[model samples]
Target: MTKRSKAFNIKKGDTVKVIAGKDKGAEGKVISVLIDDQRVIVEGVNRVKKHEKVVNQGGGNTGGIVTTEAPIHVSNVMLVDGEGVTRVGFRREEATKTRADGSTYTVQRSVRVSRKTGKDI
Candidate 1:
């Protein structure tokens, strides 16, 4: 079996605010998560420019100076919950699951919680 990536409190499509670095105070939707590196790419945040060389003159993968969002350390961002940013907390709750053979079982699953509101985020 393929190795599994570590779970993170932040996930793709989550709104996050940059807490440090050049993009501090900026809030944007999460574009992707880098589990191993503990970094995340937030839309329109931590943008960097890269110059590319044209691979072909036929309009395939046109090369030029491109500005794109760079991955920032996960610690530099805070998940946006409700009206403001809040620290992420995890709690376990019982959930029912169906077995492959048709048996039902209860399992505890970790849920993301908002530190500020004490509600599921």
Candidate 2:
């Protein structure tokens, strides 16, 4: 059996929909990607509470629960566009020759879009 490399098609800023966890079906922007771990942290998904202690100069530290987002497995999410359609692959545009002006310009590239907006960021 061939070992599959841990790689995520999702990128930073890519809008993703959580397919699992407590935030299932929730959509948010990708805040960061942990390629090595095959995990990505969405803007508002997989929230985990962290207990923190406040150290005082005079006495001991006070502990409390701090709510924050946690890293989710990339496989549990899907990339979505403004039309709410999921994306499968990365879209890249190559420079092509134009006849009229003969100048190089970027064309409309098909990339993943945010489900909230049809515009690619």
Candidate 3:
């Protein structure tokens, strides 16, 4: 059997804010996560320009400079919650229990709370 890999609480569609680098304070939704590289591509962070050459296609076409966001290390991003502040790890109230046909499934929740106010975040 293949061993399961460590679970990263962050998901692809999560909102995050850049805490470091040239794009500091920029916020965007997560596009993709690279677990192996520990990187994430935000909607508008670490933008880099790419020069493209026009390829001859029978029809009219053009190629020029395109700006795209490059993946930044996950450590550089902080998950932003409803309050729009950086999150600090905290314990959840309890595991959600689901029962179907007498089978129970307990889903563990990871809560991110405010580091400053000590409230749910």
Candidate 4:
């Protein structure tokens, strides 16, 4: 049997803070998300040195001991809100809309909300 992983609420472009690991307390904007590995690469967090070979393709590409952000486990980070790090929650809301014939209908939408303040994120 196999288990499915839950979708991550943290997405690219969101500000997050590291809650655990060597980079604990570090805060940065989320640069990318690795859903399959359940890891997130936050800007300026979990940096590591990489050795690369210089390529003679187009413009000269210099490569040697380059420092870059490394992927951190998603669970070690928390989304940052107005009041600081807080857990994320989902809220479903109904919206009423009218069509060209003046007919009304309802649609449901889900939004990410802050658990601490219960406000939309």
**Model 2 residue 95 CA deviation in Å:** 3.2
Candidate 4 is scored at a TM of: 0.87
After aligning candidate 4 to the native by TM-score, how far in Å is the CA of 76 from where it should be? 0.2
TM-score of 1: 0.87
Tell me the deviation in Å of residue 116 in model 1. Answer: 0.8
- Model 4 weakest 10-residue run by lDDT: 1-10
Q: State each candidate's clash count.
A: 0, 0, 0, 0
lDDT of 2 by residue, 51-98 (tens): 988878788657688888899999899887655647565455555557
Over 62-91, each residue of candidate 1 has an lDDT whose tens digit, in order, gives 889999998999999999988899998999
Model 2 TM-score (2 dp): 0.63
Candidate 2, residue 7: how far the Cα is off, in Å: 3.8
Ranking by TM-score: 4, 1, 3, 2
RMSD of 4: 2.4
Best by lDDT: 4
lDDT value for model 3: 0.79
User: Cα deviation in Å at residue 33, candidate 3?
Assistant: 0.8
